[model samples]
Target chain A: MDQFTLNLIVVGATFALYFGIAIWARAGSTAEFYAAGGGVHPIANGMATGADWMSAASFISMAGIIAFGGYDTSAYLMGWTGGYVLLAMLLAPYLRKFGKFTVPEFVGDRFYSGTARVIAVICLLIISITYVIGQMSGVGVAFSRFLEVSNDTGLYIGAAVVFAYAVLGGMKGITYTQVAQYVVLIIAYTIPAIFISLNLTGNPIPGLGLFSNDTASGVPLLTTLNGMLADLGFASYTEQHDTTLNMFLFTMSLMIGTAGLPHVIVRFFTVPKVADARSSAGWALVFIALLYLTAPAVGAMARINLINTMYPNGVKETPVARADVPDWVANWEKTGLLKFDDKNGDGLINYTSSAETNELDVNKDIIVLANPEIAQLPSWVIALVAAGGLAAALSTAAGLLMAISSAVSHDLIKGQLNPGISEKGELLAARVSMAVAIGVATWLGLNPPGFAAQTVALAFGLAASSIFPVLMMGIFSKRINSKGAISGMLVGLIFTVVYIFLHKGWFFIASTASYSDSAPMLFGIKSTAIGSIGALLNFAVAFIVSNATEDTPAEVQELVESIRIPKGAGAATGH
Target chain B: MADKSSSNAYWKANIRAIQIFLVIWFVCSFGFGILLRPMLAGIKIGGTDLGFWFAQQGSILVFLVIIFAYAAKMNKLDREHGVEE
Candidate 1:
């Protein structure tokens, strides 16, 4: 079968599986809808959370980023996964003990202020919306590439499929579907990686193969790759180009940001026991690390393979004839993801990037999504990759939509708008909220405020500064009263957003954004590294504000201590 | 009552253990990978400096080990604390 047909079959079957699970596992009660009835097995919840957390960035963009950015891109790998450690150690267990349905619920109850709740809700909405935009666009990209539809048309189909499961199944249904999605994505991701690894290094395990010697030339694969990339004027695949300070701070920001993200944090609430929350986080990281470990391998190997295909004999050799170019080049060229221009009117495909030498400019996002075709792998593998990308996007989108819907229905309409609401009425409200969330996400996916997916990093930065701080203070420090929490969040939220907007538009940093990261970062801090500093500012302001305010009530003080000690912690469900 | 006291002691000890492990985490990732990277810059690994490995793969692998070890040890701690469910 051709790549398109194979992708259609694989992606079609994956969606059919998710939709079927949604039908079979439709949530019956608000509790089930919201928390998966608080009884998910620890390992199962871990897998689902892994699926939710990875998203389009992890599945599609990461390998591509590393392939091109070389070792400097390790910031992404370490920063993202290292954050899981912080999550498991610092935040997850405590939040699970709080036993709330939503991150905002914990915020409201712990701070004893509706203002704190509202701030958290705003942060959650911003994070979820920005995050979802990427997922929807990813869905669209995958569909357009594999299913022969336009990007917008692909988004509409993706939105429809997402609505089918998210509205009907709620968290309960979403959890199981996400777990299934995780399996599909990992299988799809690892299969091509294994093949490429064996072909390159004669090592079956891509993770180990990255460090091992190249069987063909008896040199370390990374060593060979770095030399070749440098010869072409690109940074070596293993060489560090970023300043140490920036790398450290960037990784720290991602770690704190990951720990603070409300969507990932809320997953712990679904498990039955405090221990389960702890163990679940560990399991989630294990699953996530499976791909994270292999990403560098794939990135390095793909860079090598791409250079080889372009040069044919070796990177030092003359370029290959376009008309006689390999079949893989033609396949990806049709998708417009892979391309070569004979800038000097030479029939050969030039693969260098210096001012003097002609070069082919490849989109960084295509390195992973277009990998199988680029390597001339089997059509089935190409199809599997398409399905995997969709799974990554859909699973994350479902989670984000659930967060948005529950915030509106459970927190806004049910909790505050009408506490006297009947169960039947609330269920309807949840469905309505879910529908609205998906609609808004889909619309934004089309005419994005900017680079739809890139806004995702800003969402993390905002979460790092605003919501995470308030949640930590509320649960861990009773002295941090409602007044302190609210003020601190306001300050953090304002400063972080302003910093990003000045660089990005007030909304997003499209290709047209005035201030690039290369532009003067505040105090020499890269935009990506700004969140950790914002977090510090948040902590400082909270402490100062709390000290200025009156003492906490005796009962609230006791509540904080109890949560701290993890005594009387209740079982939570993953919906 | 004695068992509860013993369990509390176990939990305290486990916290101390986690603290020690976290220090190592910082030293490898934050220290060798960043602040002290210059100190290790002269020492190379596979053509790149020693600091680079810690920044990328070494720190992350260590982090994974720390978490998994903590989970297993913490489970034991919980069992000894009489808190395991």
Candidate 2:
């Protein structure tokens, strides 16, 4: 059979599986809609969280970023996974114990303030919406490439699929579907890495393969890669080029941000016990680590493969004739992700670090998607990759949609707008909000703003700077009153947003920025790394405001004390 | 359920444990993986040094261990404090 048929069959099969799970797991109540009826097994919840957490960026773009960025991008690996540490220790268990349903519910109840809850709802909306746009766009890209459709058509299909599952089944359906997605995405991710690793280093395990000898050169894979890159005027593969402070802060931001993200935190609420919440985080990391560990190896190997393919004989030898370029290059060039201009009219493809002399311009996003094709992997494997990418995008989109809709329906509409709304009415509201959220995400994906690229940093920054600190302070400090929480969130939100806008154009409009990232306004700290500073400011501000204001209510103090321990958690369920 | 003082002690113990683990977490990722990396460059691993290993793989593995260890310890604390559900 042809590749297109295989692609359709594999992708279709995965969709069928997801739809089946969604039908089997349709949510019957608000409790199930919001927290999977608070009875999810720890391991299953962990798997669902893994799928929820690893977005299209993790599946399609992260390895590519690591491949090109080399050691500098380790921040993403450590930052993303390390946040689970913070979640497991500092956030997850306590939240699970305190949990009724949504994150804003905690903020509202813990602070004893409607304003704080509304602020949290706003922050949750901004973060989830911005984050979901990227996932929607990723779905479009995957569909366009594999299914041979326009980007718009791809996005619409993706939106429809997400709408069907998310709106119908809510968290329960999303949870089970996410488990299947985790399996698909991980298998799809690791199988290619395994094959590539064995080919490059004679090791089947890609993580260890990275440290093993390259089969061709009889030296460490990284060593060979570094030597080749250096010979080609590129930085060493294993050496750090970015500044220590920026890398440190960026990692810190991602860690906190990951811990703060509403969707990820809400996953813990699904588990039956606070103890399960803690261990579930560990299991989530184990599942996430499966992909994270394999990523660096895939990145390094793909880089080596690219150079080898281009050089054929060696880096010092004649480059491949333009006419003789690999079929993978042609295939990717058609997608406009890989370009060759044959500079100097020499008809030779010169892949190098020097910009002026380079004849190939490969988008970093294509590295993983094109890896199988580049290495001449079978058609079925490539088709599986397409399905995997879609699963990654769809699962994350569903999770983010869940967070968005719950914030609107549960936190905003039910909590504030109409406290008297019945459970059935609330469920209807949740589905409507979910559908609306997906529609907005689809529209944004179709007409992605110029800042679409910066949304990851923005989402992470807002979460790290605003949501995370407040949640932590809410749990860890009873002295913090509602006033303190509100002010801290606002200050952090404004500071991080302004800092980012100044560097990335005011509101992401190119002409309005007074400062550029190349010459940052403060201490050479890139806007991306400023979230940690914002977090610190938030912590400091909260302490100051709380000390100056009235102390927390006695009953609120009791609530804080209750969440710290893991007892009577079952009694804490549902409003 | 335990009385307030006993619960307070459990909370205190939990805080102490968290402090210790967070210190380890910071040391592994930010210290060995970044700032202290130059100091650990003398110790070689594969083609790169130990610091590179920490940045890429070692720190993640350490994070995994820390989380699971914390969970186990916290579970024990929960049971000892008579707080386990």
Q: lDDT tens digits, residues B1-85, model 2? A: 5689989999999999999999999999999999999999999888999988898899999999999999999989988989888
Which stretches of model 2 miss by more than 4 angstroms? Answer: none
- lDDT per residue as tens, model 1, A142-221: 88878999999999999999899889988889899999999999988998999899998889999878877888788888
Q: Candidate 1 chain B: minimum summed lDDT over ten consecutive residues — where?
A: B1-10
lDDT on C-alpha atoms for all candidate structures: 0.81, 0.92
Q: What value does the TM-score of chain B take for model 2?
A: 0.96
Worst 10 residues of 2 chain A by lDDT: A566-575
Evaluated against the true structure, the overall lDDT of model 2 is: 0.92
For candidate 2, the TM-score of chain A alone relative to the native chain A: 0.99
- The candidate that wins on TM-score is 2
DockQ of each: 0.43, 0.85
Q: What is the lDDT of residue A78 in candidate 1?
A: 80
Fraction of true A-B contacts recovered by candidate 2: 0.80
Q: Report the C-alpha lDDT of model 2 over A103-198, residue by residue, as the tens digit.
A: 999999999999999999999999999999899999999999999999999999898888888888999999999999999999889888999999
